[model samples]
Target: MDYAFAGAMSGLVAGIIVCPLDVVKVRLQNQPPISLTNYNGTFPTLVRIAKEEGLKGLFSGLSPTILSYLCDRMLWFATYESFKVAISNHTTRKLDDPFVHSGSALLSSVVCVVGITPLWVIRTRMMTQNTETIYYYRSVSHAFKSIIKKEGLTSLYRGLIPSFLGIAHPLIQFPLYERFKIVISNYEHHSKLEDYNPNKRPELSNLGILTSSIVSKFIAAVITYPHEVIRTRLQTQTAPLNKNFSNNTSVIPNIVPYNGIVKTVKNMVVEEGWKSLYKGLPTNLIRTIPSAGISLWTYEMILNNMKNI
Candidate 1:
């Protein structure tokens, strides 16, 4: 019934459904510009991962992925709902107003991004870890311990800036969703007046909600995709090898520092061209649309059911 609980449940379901796609996306995004290993595309990458590493590979980092999203979505919805209520109390506008919803979504996303950045860093590192590479993480705990011990606490927040930029995603998505809801509701009301069918109204609302979720997610993902690439690069950038671990012999090459978001974008464009900023975007869309739609549907369903109870 609680917003946080509803969000966490919805996120857990969405994360599980989208984990395989996410693993593929992360692998594709984390690839070096001029690497020996590169996936041809989403299907080929999926096949390769499955053939080489089996199902486990497809679900790599599922634990941390779900955990990160669970917490992230919980914080996001809880904060957004709380902010919406607080703002509505002060403002003349209705709580459901698109501007208020958008503002709440943006602020909530910023807060959640800060809180969940480390978990996301861990999830990305774990997902992108190639066993063939010298550095391999055994588990979520192993990844966290290794990263903290080797890279310091700040490493966990490596992509915080770009992630903050990611607030633009929900800012756009929730506003569009609210606007779409209003438009769809108005259209459905007109249709019902002509047809005078009460039974169909709920169905129309449900369809509108799902459609809005999918459309908003797609648009937001495309516009904000470049930030995703930057965030992945920042998070996956490895620390310089420790001299003490020199004898270990199985050290993966360190990732070149990405500097800051601006420098990183410039460097990527120089080395790999502007298209590089949208690497894995296709896969990202495929994953995000359904994931977001399902999440919104689930969240709304749960909230409604809880309200009835």
Candidate 2:
């Protein structure tokens, strides 16, 4: 298979593997503010949801989640690789150098944001809606249709701004991972790793790569956390107000053109309170750490294989 296709497949597998956590994270983030009186911790909340909603609830938006993830990573890696190849024609530097890898990751993320936003909107909405009304979704398509029927097609793209902003996390981390790998390879003198094939075995002992991956992910998760909160808020299904001060009243979460990103931020802060802007932040960081670390590690491994092939 082609490298791009292989990356897509690997992303799909990773998406499926990690989706349960993603669903849980989304639910936690999109939920109404937790009453201090009601819950003890994140894990307990997760347990309560699983106990109440069952195992399937834990994997609620798996289909759209996987699709969006695969599509995003595929485009990201492909674009990154293509950029590296093009840059190679203009420079004599090694392709696996830290700069090259980081540059690729940054570039690829820009491409992915354009396409991935809609899918993410759908996934988050499905995950966070009231369970009773949300049950209309027999599958991913059904979920999407129900949203469109009631909310319009544009509803599926609700959090586009914050989501686009969130892409910077990957953009920052991927290149950082690339650079970290170089530092590791250099420290090991490259000969040891040269003989140990990534295709044949897991390279767990690559401390530099591991450390770099972990650090980069941690930094990225912290810096971009607000965007996660914003995206979740926008994507989450809202119950309609009993009365509308501005216009018609409805019993469903009606659409609001909160205008630009600034306006969106201001309205959310005024309407929901300042803390609501940071809703689900703790769950987001916890979820992002492992997901990002493993994904970056695999991306490097895949890139190494493509080079040798």
Candidate 3:
């Protein structure tokens, strides 16, 4: 019942529940035309992919998704908790220290972002690959192997630019989540009876859990969206590998260089139009809010249960 363990389980469960939507989002982002004509909704997308590509198509890249999240949740919760503890040790404030809480949350998010961005790159590629080659991966390991063989070692880290920039998820997400949690917890405390002790409160009601999650994640997604756009583009770019392929520098395109982060951003806006920046906003929002909400709810619920025991 450790909060960390619970959080991981919750995340895994949430990932499975929403993965189809994730596949849809990734495809939408990667495809140039950005068409939804083949599918009606998340469920419809799943059905259509199944009919056309079989069951494997629907669950393509699921293995990497699971592995990525397992690591992500552990680093996320542990780092946030440890950071908060470390800060409290240095400060004179009590448990309600807003600065300590928000700061810890922010730091934790960055740690997770840096650690998991590589896995995210692989996962995204695995999901968005053409349907014909969808079954190429049997699992996360298979996906990694295939990518390395075909795209080289750097392929595993295709999205590092935008992913690193997305370190803002923690800066933007955790503080808002903490604030929302505080608000909900405060409301519950005041509404209860004089003899009521929230310290011994039973498992959070499903409604409360869902409510806290939606509000926190929605706010965080809205704030951190633009960064999400940049990260996706950088991760999914088709720039040639940096390594020496047959020692031919001429093979690389000198006209459209993919060097430097700012240059990439400028290129995207200037060449591809401003709308290109927001390519995956719809899918990003659909994926982020629920993914974040379930993660937070599961963490809190598990943490509270363990503490009570």
Of 1 and 2, the candidate ranking higher by TM-score: 1
TM-score for all predictions?
0.92, 0.77, 0.79
Regions of model 2 farther than 4 Å from truth: 33-40, 87-103, 130-135, 190-206, 237-251, 254-260, 268-275, 302-309
Candidate 1 has an lDDT of 0.83
The most accurate candidate by lDDT is 1
* Candidate 2 structure quality by residue, lDDT tens digits, 118-190: 7877777656544434234556777666666556677677777777787788777766765566556655665
- Which pairs of residues collide in candidate 3? 159-235, 162-231
Evaluate model 2: give its TM-score. Answer: 0.77
Query: Which residue window of length 10 is worst by lDDT in model 3?
Result: 247-256
lDDT of 3 by residue, 264-301 (tens): 66876786677766666676678877776677677777
* Deviation from native of the Cα of residue 231 in model 2, angstroms: 1.2
lDDT of every model, 2 decimals: 0.83, 0.65, 0.64
**After TM-score superposition, what is the CA distance of residue 1 in candidate 1 from its true location, in Å?**
5.6
List of clashing residue pairs for candidate 1: none
Q: Candidate 2: global Cα-lDDT?
A: 0.65
Model 1 agreement with the true structure over 107-152: per-residue lDDT tens digits = 8988998899889998998898766576677777887777788777
Give me the candidate number with maximum TM-score.
1
